[model samples]
Target: MTTPQTPGTWTRARAWLQTHPRAWDATLATAVLACMIVGSFADPGHHGGPKWGTRTPDAPSLTLMVLGAAALVLRRARPMTVLAATGALSLVELVTGDPRTPVAMCAVVALFTVAAHTDRTTTWRVALPTMTVLTAAGMLAGPLPWYAQENIAVFAWTGMAAAAGDAVRSRRDFVQAIRERAERAERTREEEARRRVAEERLRIARDLHDVVAHHIALVNVQAGVAAHVMDKRPDQAKEALAHVREASRSALNELRATVGLLRQTGDPEAPTEPAPGLHRLDELVDTFRHAGLTVEVARADHGTKLPAAVDLAAYRVIQEALTNVQKHAGSEAKAEVSVVRVGPGLEVTVLDDGPGHEGAPQDGGGHGLLGMRERVTALGGSCSAGPRPAGGFRVHAILPVQNHARQATAAEGTGNRV
Candidate 1:
């Protein structure tokens, strides 16, 4: 069985004292010096004075004792300096025949301060050497002859105090550096996550804008034409109404595809359908022409390739422009559509003359032009739609030519641009 713990035993003793190094140092020094003052009143033998006693300790001259007490106040600020001052005073007491055995105890306070504040290398440079010199000097030169146990006790205690203080200092520095590095790494991870999220939001916005805009515009235009012609040419009117049904169904399917982006867990399986591009321009033009608006499509000097977004944007610009003409211009209006490649970008323009109709009540919030602008701009392209200076309206768009190849090939192979 373990024995009961004592108030101040060797093992685990002073563990808490070691926690407050400076405070513990001051409290210990004051207690020890106060005890020494009391010891001065006793007889030499009764007060542990046969060898390790403070002779003449109660005498009128106690200059070294006073100096050692004053050194305690500034010990934390200048540990090594305070240690040096006390060590010098201890040496003077030993040589000048003063009665102060506890003067050697002052060196313990100095050693503790050196270990707590500075690194091992500095503690060794200042403390170990001074301890060796003072212990050796006192043993050889003090009134006590050589081989005195009291002098050797001073050396051992001072060495242990210095070692303990240095260990504490090193651990404190290591913990602080680790905390700072962890905080910096956490900040970097958060910033990277935010940047990636912003880029994905922009990408999803572009895809949804492209898929929904074109087919919806075509449906709106054809529906307008079907309503106008049913009263004049019923047979031809039925065909235009059929085209409007096809465009509306196509729009619903594309909108479903756009909404699927919200469930993006991984690589999505390819659907049984596909996206429409420029080759569909013929069918698109035919649908409007059947509706009684003459659409002339002019394509020249085609290139080998174009990006998917650019191809899609070009198709949408033409589709939206024609739809606007059918809605705003009179039934008799004739629209001219042109697709031409100039430099690295493709230009699609639809210019129409005034329909020769009177006073139209232009009204309602239409998503047509807004959707067209969104589509072209998503691909770093530009689209402009406004009333023509001649009499009607014109929509001109410039789409970069790099993405035209896949569109051209896809249109040719399908032979059905619908």
Candidate 2:
């Protein structure tokens, strides 16, 4: 078994230091000053091994070391200024001190800060000059020989610091870019999910409207007829009541199917009836005929098998159009429905020879015409509904016969060629 561990004192302290940059820089400067002061007392010229406390740095050397270390306190906020100040102090110590002090250590740290904060071009421009001037001063004017190890050490240490800082900067930039890309990708996925949800809601609303509007309109007409004729003619009233019952039953079945789309996966199974299509045009026209509206259907499309989406869109367009005509046109109105296959498309048109009504969908008071347009448009088709130039109203739609997969493949091919 594994156990989670709480943060230790050191971890907590490190986190706190990271949040307070000025304090951390001050701490670093103190440590560097301590190191420089201790190093100044060591002698490399001792007979045996190099010994500490065998020599003391002159006043000028001590002063340069203190100034260089003090400048590093503002290294992050003013990297370029710190580098210049420390470099000048190191050059002074290299030229004047008989035994050069460790003032150049502060310059190396400042150079590293500059590289980590600035771009590569700026770092390179600043670092090269600083390294050259410091190394040249140590080699040319110091009390020690030009070929001394200390002179070469300055060059090597400064180069390493600049390289290390640049590596840190590059890694940080790469990590930040990766984090931003992930966030943007997550946002895109969320937006796509929301868009799909909105589309699904609109689709369900249209389905409910189609089911309720068509069946209820028929039921309403039949009920009104049955109520009117009940006293005068019992037989005709019973027949009208039977028609109302049938219309209501059909409406209930369609409502169950439509509402079932919102059920959970483990819910009871819904009705398995196939969705109504152009194949059921006869049945659809009959219901309107029973309501006393004369409907005539003509077909020139042959027995063509359409993709499911196109078939459904065509059915819905016809259904909504007929519903509008039955509701808006007078009892003596006659309707004509035509299905024609032209070129690569199937066209459906509905015309009713009724005096145009102000309450019609063409006047923008209902969703019947709008739903038809949405259904056709979703299938990459076109739909138009308007009052006829002669009389009555007309609804026409043209739907492409291609399935989604074929259309997608053709689109991909075109994109590749382009």
* Cα RMSDs, all models: 10.4, 3.3
- When summed lDDT is taken over every stretch of 10 residues in candidate 1, the lowest stretch is 355-364
Give the residue spans of candidate 2 off by over 4 A.
Answer: 1-6, 44-49, 403-405, 408-418
Clash count for candidate 2 is 0
Residue 220 of candidate 1: its Cα lDDT? 64
lDDT of 2 by residue, 125-144 (tens): 98899889989998988888
The clash count for each model shown is 10, 0
TM per candidate comes to: 0.53, 0.92
Predictions in order: lDDT: 0.69, 0.89
TM-score of 2: 0.92
Q: Which candidate is the best by lDDT?
A: 2
Report how far off residue 336 is in candidate 1 (Å). Answer: 2.7
**In candidate 2, where is summed lDDT lowest over 10 consecutive residues?**
402-411
